[model samples]
Target: MIRVHIARQFDVRAADGRRLNAEELHAEGERLMQSLLDLEQCNDDFCDSVTATDADKGTVLVELLISDETETGAFEKSRTIVRTAIHAIGGATPWEASADLGADYRPRDVQLEYV
Candidate 1:
């Protein structure tokens, strides 16, 4: 089995073009983390664990551990799972996400925009 570490950073923003206050930001971060955790529960075949390491300054940091037969499969699966979690949250617009895979692989950057 291949173990891959994925870190995703999300720049969360309100739909009305206003910055979210600290309280709102924290709530949003929690929601996002919960969404990921929920997904992890269903995707046991590939996802090993999901963690919300930080949520502050209009950004949410999520770390994911995925195991698969190949590195490419793990990376792609991680991206799909994260995108699904983001979409599941809903309401948050113009979300931007970038990811860093662990040391052996080059970082895979992804941008997500909700219309």
Candidate 2:
């Protein structure tokens, strides 16, 4: 099993292009985390479990326990699962993501920019 820790910073904005308040941002972060948990429940073959927490304002920390035979396979699957969870929470965008694959493995810094 490989443990993947992902940190994401979201600059959430409303439809009118205004930044979201602290309360709204917190709610959105909770929603995003719930989405990830739901995805893990559905895709048991790729992931063993998922947990998320609010690191700071506009930032979320997600830890995914992945069950893959190889390190490369785990990395690839983690990327796909994270992306799917983000997309599931429609309208949440313009965020940056980075991943840490334990102590021995070099951290993978993956960022997604949406317009």
Q: Which model scores highest in lDDT? A: 1
lDDT of 2 by residue, 20-109 (tens): 566766665676678777886778744433333333433344456666656667667766776666667654333432232110111234
- By TM-score, the best candidate is 1
Estimate, for each residue in 26-62, the C-alpha lDDT of model 1 and write its tens digit: 7766776788778877777545444342334556555
Distance from true location, Cα of 55 in model 2, Å: 7.9
What is the lDDT, from 0 to 100, of the residue 106 in candidate 2? 14
Per-model CA lDDT versus the true structure? 0.57, 0.50
Question: What's each prediction's clash count?
Answer: 0, 0
Candidate 2 is scored at a TM of 0.56
RMSD of each: 9.6, 10.2
Residue 58 error, candidate 2, Å = 2.4
Per-model TM-score versus the true fold: 0.67, 0.56
